[model samples]
Target chain A: MTVKSKHVRIKGIKDGLVFLLDDKCPFEDLLSELRYKLEHSHQNILTGPIVHVDIKLGSRIVTEEDKEAVLEILKSQGNLLIRSIDALEAPGSKENDEALFLMSGMLRSGQVLHHQGNLLFLGDVNPGGTITCSGDIYILGALRGMAHAGVEGNEEAIIAASLLSPTQLRIADIISRPPDEWGTRESSMEFAYLTNGAMQIDKIHNIVKLRQGLNVFKGV
Target chain B: MGEAIVVTSGKGGVGKTTTTANIGTALALQGKKVCLVDTDIGLRNLDVVMGLENRIIYDLVDVAEGRCRLNQALVKDKRFDELYMLPAAQTKDKTSVTPEQVRDIILELKKEYEYILIDCPAGIEHGFRNAISGADKAIVVTTPEHAAVRDADRIIGLLEQSHVESPKLVVNRIRPGLVKSGDMLDIEDILQVLNIDLIGIVPDDELVIKAANSGEPTVMNPDSAAAIAYRNIARRILGDAVPLMQLDRKPGAFSKLKKFFGMG
Candidate 1:
């Protein structure tokens, strides 16, 4: 039986089948049609070697009840699994996944570099230059200028530099200071991260051990 | 065609005008027809420094504004027959002359002179832009101080951006006592920071002040230490192998002791 529903559209992707749900359709009818399709639609590849499928609700707000209804309908199918359910319709999240911006050469005074995701600078950030980014920042040379990381208020962002003698540094809403004698230790590799609403800086290699030591202390 | 060199220091009172006057005079002494153009319009002091202030009948603005011919604005130097000074107008500010106007004036001067030295004003504003616009080469003057060196570095970057590649550095007003005592930046320190070719090092000589007050540049004095430095710089600009004089080392201990004892 061919069940033609106006609200339900199917797409075949590399992973599995993707059901594009329309928000105009009633939740009860949508779930029932999805269930009916899951049970009888063998030509749609619900049972063969394919194990999972994705559901994309375009411009639709899915509540907890709606999620339960979807899960309940998908649970009745024995071998098929729901891989992912994306309903927000946010822009750039998928396009900018793990995107990196690279800049090379000396950034002199009155120069500025702005990037959305992680910034990988292969040159020195001179005294009057600045770099601002929404994600993490990695500078392979000396950072003598200002670096504002986590510009989109991402508190988990980190800034690592080979020679971190920055004029100023900001991570999320927190500001940090370079050690007073930083220039004396020119080759010291350092990094900064937000901790307890404040930025903390430490040597790059010690961060892992410091976190592990904290975990051990919590265990004891 | 004559070489157009813009003498500029991003910071004021670092002897850019003085350097321009001295270098132009030094070049003229070697029988080269040199024309010194004062691009600092409002603060017109290059003429006064060169002792041509009283002879300024028609300034750069006069020539640019079509009030006088280009030769009428050229103030002849009293000391050297080949040397000349195109003085800036005292009443007008820097905007009275545009970059194109300055370039046109410099082009006109280039047809007559063997070297055209533009005395660029302090600060990287419209005036500095106007001065460096016509120049094919640049001479960056800086003192042995942090602020001066920093400004010099910025000027060098701007010069490179403006197509004046590899501007030579001339470190002025270096005190050997302060440098030897590790209290001030030395030539090597400045060279390390600016990272440009050092064309000259003019030591802190009282003769510069004496020469300036008399409205004659120090390069005209045959015996002044700064005069020798400027002369050597002029020779180097002519592609001569002139060694940078040791401005840091003082006279030997024996000479000092001899002077203290009032003996020769």
Candidate 2:
């Protein structure tokens, strides 16, 4: 007897699985099909190798209810991995060497941005908004917010902002807020980095050079 | 339409019950129908604070569990014809009520009242979730202490995460003497950390205790400083731009003389 195999193309990325579903199929149907594929295949659905699922919704804006349903399915399957929806037409993957991401949007209160690479913002970091980066962060607008760079203990991570009036700033183990005496200084870029085992900020122009050494701030 | 406002403080003893009573009374005094829902089941104190404990024939848990009708559980205040109190069940636990039941009750109350003030229990647990589920807005009460501030911060975070927009701040029990001496956290300090709009600041007043004992909200007393502050807060909520009270002013001999003479 000959059996025809039902195959779903799967591409493994460094993070997890990238599953592409046809836009014609409804999301619910797609979920059921994926479940059936996982159950009948040699791969174990419970302890599957896939740790992440990036669904390419392709031109469709996933409704809140749809997102909840997707989350529910993953949760019930005991596979609560990080899931993200991406537009199929999104730009091609950029090289990891180019680690800078420039985001320009109002981060409303209560929203958090967690980036594993450098981040630059051209807008205000409103109160109650937070930015956590494993690399450096630079904000061109007022920083009346919280910023944590080098969160993964990267001491070399630096934070610079046009207006250095943050509620709190953290780089590695050191945390500091603008001194009250620094009260409303002129709008100029200030750089913060580890100095003498403590986080310190000074005029960006003063650092005439940047030395790439162990916790050394080479004057720019 | 009536709005449901949750009076919550993540930490205990920040005066949520007191604020609920004062705001409820203030709104009632403005000729609006108001009902206060006490959601702190098993530890009901809003009834005592509002001086309606003796009038409570049925409680919130009874209404939620279908043991009593909503109208039967509502306790009308003796001082205000339009003000009513839904006392929490002293015998039932927080789990006796669910968020869905609270939402249903609030929706029903909205049809009959202009304001529904829910007295939320302390701590960010099941009770807090149930209390806030039906709220249109929230007033977070906090004292000027490190622990209170930290807990308020956490609550603010949770509220934001749950998508409760525009949570206003009320710094209760502020001691002017401590603030003036830099011993207590000032309004500016709290505002800087919490980053929420300040609605009111109630200075520590012994009259508050006296008013609670008499089942009268301080907001009804014209001479009480805290009462005046609460009234001003009510006006602000009504979209009036009332200026915040100057709590840092020193009570010098001249001020005392002016008080004695009944002149500024």
Candidate 3:
């Protein structure tokens, strides 16, 4: 009977989580090992809201009651829901998980906030201030300065703000208009997205149709 | 120890020297011992504005270079006995006195005066950094123009990162008529960009030029609108609550219509 952290590897997906279970181990041993690792939360994650999870059993045969046992173990530790039990790893689940950074307080003139992944800022960015993110940029407050999203050439990245009045905005390799041209001063929440290799501004509510797989959770 | 306040404006000709001279004089008039240090070095004007240029035996560089003592370098104001001026050298460039020397001079002045108002030179160069190095607080001066306000914003960012407390704003040379006609940037427009507490707003007054021509600070002129505005700023510095003086100049053509009807 062997139970290691590798037997129950947790991989993060785009909007959900994937759990890869070891196949060589005995059924009862794997269950006990999964229970032990989850009970301790080796990764120390998933204490937040209920997260959707997909289980991958590598060439292992398991009954419905055995799958229920695995679910019961994960459910006791935190809010986690098992979406599926497959024989192989899900596609596109191998990408390294990029965290979503959240920060409060406004950025004054000449101040800049840079993050590797997605950024969710809770304050304004005054003129001469800037925010650069490799992934998506979501600002809950006014953005009056420059914001460069997808700095690592991820063109799919979007920049959203409550008040979308920026001096300049850049998505991947594309740079938009100057202050006068970009000065729409939208009163409502809006987001700037790249479509057809051109940047466009729209209401925040339309983000669902803009990005696919972004509408992961529906009717909730 | 006295509180040293550095008056700075990133853009030139926005009234940094004028603000410092008047605020120092106004503080002296309140019976608080005040010293004004002109860090402009080559383009020394605070001394000229305060009518203390003639009395300067040694300037700031002389004091820093060990050619003269602090008392010998400071020019005593003619009108106010409690006010003094540390004139900048007329010949040397800004690099003559280092920031360390400026801090040392300020540390020494702190023991004797209630307030030390440092007149920072224009631009965010060596002189600007030296002026704010030892100050406890900062006052950013700018006119109601896009360029001036933009430069002031940059200066505020640098000051906030320095040892000094958050800098206050003073929108100098505001023209109410121009602002009313939407030609000039109003106080709110400037404040929105600067994003700092406003210490005062000095209206564009011809008397300020008249006073500067004679090497006299405008704060000494009781009837001048700019003088009153400067006085109110000095009061605010002393923790006194002074309402902002109305920007409508009484002698102006538009103001006369409102004044005659008692509606202004």
* Candidate No. with top lDDT: 3
| Positional deviation of residue B177's Cα in model 3 after best superposition, in angstroms | 1.0
TM-score-best of 1 and 2 = 1
iRMSD value for model 2? 5.0
- Candidate 1 lDDT for residue B197: 92
Give TM-score values for chain A, per-prediction. Answer: 0.54, 0.50, 0.54
Q: What is the lDDT of candidate 2?
A: 0.80
**Candidate 2 ranges with C-alpha deviation above 4 Å:** A1-99, A102-113, A121-131, A139-148, A151-153, A161-203, A211-220, B248-264
Ranking by TM-score: 3, 1, 2
Model 3 off-target regions past 4 Å? A1-98, A178-186, A215-220, B248-264
Judging by TM-score against the true structure, name the best candidate: 3
Q: Candidate 2 residues A1-220, lDDT tens each?
A: 2213322344567877766655665666656665565555525534755378676655654656665665565555556374786643323233341368888754544568888778988877766679889888988887767999999898878889888777799999888877662455666789888877687777887655554333555579
Output the better candidate (1/3) by lDDT. Answer: 3
Error of 2 at A144 (Å): 9.4
lDDT tens digits by residue: candidate 3, A1-220: 4354467788899878898888997777778888776766554676777788998887776666777788788778667887887863333332322556788876776788898888899988887788999899999888888999999999989999988888899999999965465554547998888988888888988888877666466675
Look at candidate 2 and give me any clashing residue pairs: A207-A220, A208-A219, A208-A220, A209-A218, A209-A219, A209-A220, A211-A218
Instruction: Give lDDT tens digits, candidate 3, residues B1-264.
Output: 999999998999999988999899999988999999999989999878887777779989999999989998888889988899898999999998899999999999999999999999999889998899889999999999988887887788788779999899999998889999999999988887777899999988888998988988888988677888999999999999999878765556567556435687
**Prediction 2 TM-score vs. true:** 0.67
Residue A86, candidate 2: C-alpha displacement in angstroms: 30
- Name the 10 consecutive residues with the lowest summed lDDT in model 3 chain B: B253-262
